[model samples]
Target chain A: MKTWIEKQKALIDFTLASLARRKIKNLGLLLVYTLIVFLLASVMLFTHALRKEAGKVLENSPEVIVQRLVAGRHDLIPPGYLEKIGRIRGVQKKEGRLWGYYYDGVLKANYTFMVPQPDALMAVESGKIAVGATMARMRGLVPGNTISFRSYSGKLFSFEVSSVLPNKSELVSADLVLLSEADFRAFFELPPGYYNDIVLSVANPLEVRNIATKLSTLLPDSRPILREEVLRTYESIFNWREGIVLVLLSGAILAFAIFAWEKASGLSAEEKREIGILKAIGWETGDVIKMKFWEGALVSLAAFLLGYIAAYLHVFRFSSWLFEPVLKGWAVLYPRFELTPEVDGFQVATLFLFTVFPYAVATIVPIWRAAITDPDAVMRG
Target chain B: MIEVSEVRKAFNQGRHNEYWALKGISLTIEAKKVTALCGPSGSGKTTLLTIIGCLARPTSGRVRLKERDISGLPERFLTDIRRSTFGFVFQQFNLIKGLSALDNVMLPAYPLGGDWRALRARAESLLDSLGLAHRREARVEWLSGGEQQRVAIARALVNDPEVLIADEPTANLDTALSKEFLAILEALAEQGRTVLLTSHDPLVVEAAVIDSVIDMRDGQIVGIR
Candidate 1:
């Protein structure tokens, strides 16, 4: 076993030297290989981070939300519905939430406006508002700066920025604004006993789904969204987007496959001579194949590690501008947030099996064929 | 001792383009002596050398090295025999080009699965004996033809094999280097290692220390001296 390990080390050393000898060609392949892995990994990591961030915020979300539907469209729920929901068997607490989207003509972007809870981090005064850090940056608004926007009622409402939300909450609150209830109701022209939706908590976690079903039965036109369903929806959306990007990236992947195949199948004249010489010098067919295996494995493993680390930095640290347009294409105001750093063993294994395994296998037939032939025939050629 | 009897090799067998490279050639190579095979091009001298070296299989007949018939063995067993018992020097000095001289010499022993330190030491000693110690770290491509030939010889001796086979080993060298290579082979034979070589060079065939000269024509042994 010690001897076998030493031989492997020697083989690895020889492979590194051989690869370095053809630095220009091999470096070019490494760069292109790294880029392919980077693009695919960035897409995967970004979507994963988005889903994870959404899931984190969902932990704080109400177990169920009841929204009124009229004529197949969402409408304001009557505050009376909250009282009825609070009376349900599993209902622990129920609150009426007032929120709507306000489109700023000046910035040409939409910001979510909501009434702040009493125990919220930022308690707004009657006419003041607290905005998110990204919102503040987009509008050049700081604390004590006043901004104005026209509501759905065609009335202009102005409020002073109290404080911007911290960067840690940027994923969820990037476009959120919080104001007092009086100002929120007046700005949206929402009357008393009405809310955009009603959020309800259940005393028992398992009974939450049961409460949702009961609520749907009681209010025929009401839609009760479960937290799990929301998470599943988030996952599917990202998966769909990832599938589309993969389709677009297939061209590059195909190009790499062709490159690998060409290199493996052609077996350069120099390579043939080397194999012939090795066999001529009393090296067995297994030994020659083992050396070639090390060569392929070294190249594949180096490319994998370099590509993965580079993709990690690109997605989480550098924000992956290369793939930003494709992933966040539809959003005019892209979220300025860092993706959480995550390393998924399964994904790394998948990348290895996908990228390295085939390239390694591509070499076996060619190497074996060279090994099995008479050394004189190959050297003479 | 190595014995060959009625060996024949045909390429493109069972086809219209079939050509026989060797036909019914039988000879014996004595241990601890220098023997030479002299023939013109296409005389099948190299083919016979390869069969005896276990580098190729014969279509018929037997090759017995120490009374073991190896002509019909499977490839894996043949490979093991080749690794443990035979060292080969080719006409083109087929040293793996990118590796240094020491590395090339050490290539044959990698499959032996021993302490690499011992292997390196053995390779180093062989290179030192061949006056190539100073050139140990130089790549084969950077070395001259004579230096490359010496490196190939060192590689052939690294495994301490019982038999050494050379096919036109002096084909690429000038007269001076060819004579030097012959002297090295004579010394190796003096050390009790059997040496068999094929050469077209008269200087190589007429060397004073050769035990016998075998001449071939049309893939058949024409004379033995």
Candidate 2:
């Protein structure tokens, strides 16, 4: 009997020659299979990267935030809430903030604002107002330049841009502008002591829930928000988008599965007779199985590689357009992000095992059954 | 050497269908002899040959090759026995259409790998000896029926099996080609290899230098000569 390696080599050689003979059919199958895989890989990579970016932005943000809820609407807390929240034992530092939404009637764009620099009081900046990089670029605004718009209260407010900031978080930074608390009040014509919210930094984040409970009891109308809650909301939104993508692309996956099964099992009567001839010539059932295995492996491996490469270029590079609706929902996503190509070796290995191995195994079942039959019976047909 | 003891094989069902292909027939083929099993269509000639070659299991009774009972062996073991001990030549030649005549001949040796160069040398010599050396590189599909038959013969003999089985070996060929093919089989028999062949042609049965003839009708051997 021939050694296992010799049998494998012969099987591989024969399989390759057979595929080469049917170039057109095999090539068409390969192209379609690869395209689906590419799309899947790109979506997986882009969504994963977006999750990481959003997490990072939240992690570096304030531990707790105090906002006023009125008639099912989130309103700004008075500036005095800052001093009251600062007195809590676990609170390391507390700062009052002023933020609001503005609209450009000419450009038909929405802009969000937060107090900046000195009294602005967040980890990001103080009195200097920051604007989104994309918005600045689109509107032709630069640092130390004034941009004016109408606030939600319908009052016209103008502020000098302190610096144009890159959209670090595409989910959040798209249409944002920043200013000092005094500037925020003056621009929106707020009373002297009023502010939007008080953001607090805690030494230990795990104690945030306990602290918020105490704050709620002490201050009835004001509510405490944890950064974790914000991050969870973002994750839920992305999870929904992932589900939609999976549903939309599932048809392609099913088509690929069917095509692979058909290629493996749907041998013609002529092909069966040929298999009989080989068997009658003393070829083992294992050799016949090995030949079909090579055919499956070659087709799937080629498709996997080609599809992954195409997805990287088409889906990841231009992901901002593909996924914008899901990420932004009703809110507009201003800074479109470019996904960095992340090849997860484990994920790729899993994909190959899950997607290709079963198909290859499926191809062999019918061939094995036919090969083990009486060679004379096969030849007679 | 091949021994068949009261082997039975059947096919299909009911009053209209349940017909035996081979029925309680016993035969022995001596080592190094060219023996032909001849009968008309549906006479169990091919069925008997398949049982003798270990390509099919009998519905009853035992078959032994070189004193080893092959009937009860597992499929894998039977496959190994077939690979090492038997070589088959089909009526249609059954050459893979895409391969060269040499490749077709060398195929059976692929499982018994040693030096592929040595296998190639052996295949080339067998084809050369059979007057097919000039057509060694030609695709099997492009070859004449006679040429394809010679290639099939070469393939059957390539692995140096103890038993050579050829089913209706010349059914597709002209009289001249059939005679030429029989001449090759006679040469292999002279080399002390046991050959079991099936045929419906009386001319093929008469022209060949066979040691014995087993005649069958209705799946049962009616006479022996």
Candidate 3:
């Protein structure tokens, strides 16, 4: 057993040394394979991290919300609707919320405005608002800075920055400005008695449905939204964006796969004959397989590490601009996100199994065929 | 130690096409003896040598090495036998192109796996004994044909295989180098090692100094002289 182990080690060492001698050819293959693995690892890591980050943002949101819907549109609810909902049996607390979308013509960007509360879970200082970290960085805005924008009615408004929000929500958290209820109404030029939605806190979170039923009887035009529904919407948008990325990157994947297959299958007759010679001289089929396995593994590992590091810097530090247009459907200034390098062992393992394993398996059929070919026929060449 | 019984090998070119490279031929090679198989070109000498070396299997009949039927062994086991017990020197001097002479000598023993120091020492001793110490570090391509032949011989002998099989070992060498190459084989045989050599040169036959000579033609043994 000791001798056998030694023999295997020798074979591996010899194979690696031989590869080093032919560095140009082998390293070229390694680079290509590594790039593919890197892309795969980066996508997996970023997507998985996005879910956790988005979840953190949603954790602080209301358990249930009631929005007025009319003819499939979310219409504004009357301010007096909050008073009626607050009196419901399961309601713990209820508040009318004001929010609207505004466009910055100069920056070609959109921002969201939401009513802030002094003691609310997501409150900010009066006349001053919190912005998404990414939005603040891109717009070059900071605390005490003022950003001006135009509402849908073409009315101009401005707000002073109080603080910047953490970039925990990657895809779901819109670039936002948080103001007091009065400030939101004034900025959007809305009447004193209107709101976009009514956010509710419940004594029993699970009683949201019962509260919604009660509110339906009191205000039939309004629909209740469970927290899960909002989360599903967020997931759907991300999934759609992920599908687009998959489609756009499919060509690169196919090109790399073809490059790998061509390299494996297009060995010259001389190379085929060399394999025959090695087999004839006493190399086991298993040994040949192992040699090729190492070749694939070494290449993919290097590519994965380099590509992953590049993607980490590109996405987290540089705000994932490379994928922004494809993901967002337009060029939008992404806020800076400090992504802690999260090494997911399961994800790394999966990427290895997915990217490297198949390429290694694909290589075997061709190499095995070449190795087992009749030595006489090989020698004849 | 080597026996062939009515061995026949046939290759199919394609549909409805068949060619017999070797016919039913029987020969026995004695233990610890040097035997030379001599024949003209296209006379099946190389095919018979390959069969004896366990590099190829005869399509019919059987080959026995020390009473063990090797023809029935799987390709992988046959290869193991070749590496552990049989050494081959081909006519083309099949040294891996980019490797140095020392590395070439060490190639056969690589699978055996010893301490690096011991392996290197063994390879160095072989090169020195073969009078190739000066060219030990030279790449196979940079070596002369004679030097390359010496390296090939060193590779074959490095594993201390039980049988040394040389197919046209000196076919590409000058008369002087060929004579020098045969002297090394003579010394190996003197150490009680079995050496099976194939050659077409009359000068090689004269310089054999072996215990037996087998002449082959048309895949059959024509004479055992």
Q: Which has the greatest TM-score?
A: 1
Write down the DockQ of candidate 2: 0.52
Comparing only chain B with the true structure, the TM-scores of all models are: 0.98, 0.95, 0.96
lDDT of 3 by residue, B76-116 (tens): 77878888888777788777767689877776665666665
To one decimal, what is the Cα RMSD in angstroms of model 1 from the true structure?
A: 1.8
lDDT of 2 by residue, A138-233 (tens): 788898887776666676666667777765554566677776666677678888767777778888868899889978987789888889898998
Give one digit per residue, the lDDT tens place, for model 3 in A1-381: 777776667666767766776778777777777677656655666665665566566887887889899898999997678778767897887777777776666668877777765566677656678887667777888888997766667776677888877555434444776778777777778899887888888878778888878888998888889887887886777777777787788899889878876775566665565566566555666666666666666666666677778777766676566666655422265544555556688877787677767767776777777766655443332
- Residue B140 alpha-carbon offset, candidate 1, angstroms: 0.8
lDDT of 2 at A97: 68
Q: Please give the lDDT score for candidate 3.
A: 0.75
DockQ of all models, two decimals each = 0.61, 0.52, 0.52
Sort by TM-score, best first: 1, 3, 2
Pairs in clash, predicted candidate 3: A34-A303, A134-A335, A134-A336
TM-score: which is higher, 2 or 3?
3
Q: Per-residue CA lDDT of candidate 2, range B107-218, in tens?
A: 8877665567788899999999999999999989999999998898889888888888888988898889888877887787778888888987887788648888888898
CAPRI-style class, candidate 3: medium
Regions of model 2 farther than 4 Å from truth: A117-130, A137-147, A151-163, A167-171, A180-182, A318-324, A327-330, A343-350, B13-16, B112-117, B131-138, B222-225
- Give the higher-DockQ candidate: 2 or 3: 2
